[model samples]
Target: MGTSTRQLNIGFIGFGSFAQFLAKTMTKQGHLIRATSRSDYSAHLGDNFIRDMDEFMGLEHDVILICTSIVSVSEVVKSIPFHCLKKPTLFADVLSVKEHPRQLLLQEVPEDSDLVCTHPMFGPESGKDGWKGLNFMYERVRVRDEDICSSFLNIFEYEGCKMIEMTCEEHDRLAAQSQFVTHTIGRILSEMQLTNTQINTKGFEKLIQVKESAAKDSFDLYSGLFIHNRFAKQQMKNLESALERVKGLLEAKM
Candidate 1:
């Protein structure tokens, strides 16, 4: 789908680290933003903050971005007062896993409202510099008013993100092999307590980086990747089987 550059009033459902990171860029791009979360982030958002969910729905934003954790996405989406929405709005998500949110939004959101499931594929630490060359994957689950969806997506497209359009199923399968595997390795490194050494190899340093980055994120994020993505379970099994094969090879050599 084609998109045009247009300023949008975007409302974030959750104002955590990831949401804040995205808000910075959207604000820089001159999109009006408002947010409400379980905790009070009024100070952070200033006049844009709406304390009440009912009032938040009344704001009539062109897009409502779901920035909640993957595990809580269902509860969060269900809690939204869709009937209170002033108009048909575009509902988008930035969860790491795609299929879950795509399904939840499809089930929970009103039929008239549009749905776009997206994963930014970078976080606060990684995208701190800029979104240039970073991958942004999305699937247009349901869309009738295409212009609003395109305009909202343009925010990322304009920021030098490599916009990738694919089915949610395809995204989950690929992410299981790539993102899930990376996190699993990072968690394993963390478990091993891998640390810096005077003679750190280039490969070891990269592992350290992964371990640190992954450790910084909540276990909830990692768990959600495994629990929500069907393909991730197989990847986990593959990881264990690969290690076992390696162990058997070492034993044979011994």
Candidate 2:
């Protein structure tokens, strides 16, 4: 609600859960958003959804944020014809890593536009607490455009969230560590079921409790951090090596 209704026409390319949440939050700040979806979505902005690229022509959108998955993001960018993006649009995405999204920013977006690459690090369960935990970036963007990033920062900080910023290269390298490790742990924890309700200690129980609560989030989303992220493959390798060492230690004890 910090921004006035000057109505910045924001366009979102995907209409999934994360995309829906982001659009709802942005709309609350008085942004005039137009969204596109391949599937039926329930947003108030659903009228903006364009199924065919041919229908999206002549759209005077200011900022276009793509919230699609790593698998579909490439095709979305490839479909944007160069001549159609002449309005200096600002582009961003909430994809887990910068590999594909960054490639689109460089190769697909109109050359003259100010490009912003974002990664919303939180999920649907976050609710009002979401943006606080969201790690994002504004690539090659004019530092003076504080309205967009700062507004979001204020919203998050008010909710006890730390907003972190870094270049796409740094973000990807670090996410390989932060996200990959966390998801691997969450995945392992989620797959196990503890039948002894009273026998489980407080620490062990709470860790599983956290995982159970987080289980409400889409594992498919977490899978992106572990799978599509090119830089994270090495982190997985290192983890496997550490596990091998641990196995040897346990065998020695046996």
* lDDT leader: 1
CA deviation > 4 Å runs, candidate 2: 1-6, 129-138, 141-161, 194-196, 217-220
Please list the residue runs of candidate 1 whose C-alpha ends up more than 4 Å from where it truly belongs after superposition: 1-4
Residue-level lDDT tens digits of model 1 in 121-204:
887877989988899999999999888888888888888889999999999999999989999999999999999999999999
C-alpha displacement of 1 in model 2, angstroms? 12
Clash counts per candidate, in order, are 0, 0
Tens-digit lDDT track for model 2 on 76-170? 77876557654566676778877657876677666666566666667676565545444444344433355644543444354444556677778
Native-to-model Cα distance after best TM-score fit, residue 91 in candidate 1, in Å: 0.5
Q: Clashing pairs in model 1? A: none
- Sliding window of 10 residues with minimal summed lDDT for model 1: 1-10
C-alpha positional error of residue 169 in candidate 2 after TM-score superposition, expressed in Å: 1.6
